[model samples]
Target: MNPEKLAKLQSQVRTGGKGTPRRKVKKSVKPVVKEDPKIASTLKQLNVQPIPDVEAINMFKEDGKVIGFTAPRLSANIHANTFVVAGKAEEKSPEQALSDMLSRMGGGSLGPDSLSQLAKLTEGLQAGASGAGDVDDDIPDLVASEDVADSKTDLNAAD
Candidate 1:
């Protein structure tokens, strides 16, 4: 081997065969501000608590029947009494609706456990759609009584 090539090989072996030594870059970090003890003490004395999280109800209905219903897994805020339903749970089971209503009513504080019992109580409370229990059996049919008079009389008068 030539003397120059031997010196190059020896240098490469000493430096682990790297082309150039890499430089280490230092990262600049921003300093964090220290909290004032007086402010911290005042805040601690206030004893402010975070507001409880409330979940909204998402109801899905098909053909006037509830096909899907979702409730938040977390316990709701019982003191807050306003409930917002996405849509009418028209076809929902009465008990399920009532239970959801109660849960929404104040985060289930009023009667979360009363749903099944209330449902049982309201089972027979539905009114017949056809008015089958009405005492007036001779209720007039509005369509029959409607004055659907022909326009010929008005047309003759106009002529």
Candidate 2:
């Protein structure tokens, strides 16, 4: 090879002129504020002591009972405000909004016991409306053995 060509090739390799671009150096960012001593002190005061691995704290419980401390604090004021706002937004009463929310939460319009009571009340209302001996003898027993067998057959066929 020519000495001049060899020298040119060596220079190119040494300088990385024909290779990948050099990465840019990043500027260091300074924090906006100094750490507050009061905040630091508060954090130190609130810091729970580390329990030994062998004697791990039961976060879900204390003593033999479920820990009440684990429950999130109920903010009645916030709840009331949210309820009011939601009611106004939907043109509904707060009570209506609360009922709707309960229903959406899989609680239905009434609680399980409340529903059972309501059902009994409705039955009593119907019986009272029809007077004494209002129980219709024509209504067939829904859970008879033949009905059960038919239902079982239907369910099995569906599967």
TM-score on alpha carbons, each prediction: 0.26, 0.16
Q: Pick the candidate with the highest TM-score.
A: 1
Output the lDDT of residue 135, model 2: 58
Give lDDT tens digits, candidate 1, residues 1-159.
799999766665553335644334434689987757985575455553333343444353322233333433222223454232232223565446656666676566655457566665445334332244565769686674234455666667899
Give me the runs in candidate 1 sitting further than 4 Å from their true place.
Answer: 1-65, 71-92, 111-125, 128-159
lDDT of 2 by residue, 75-94 (tens): 22332342101111123332
User: Backbone clashes in each candidate structure, one number apiece?
Assistant: 2, 0
Residue pairs clashing, model 2:
none
Off by over 4 Å in 2: 1-109, 132-159
Worst 10 residues of 1 by lDDT: 81-90
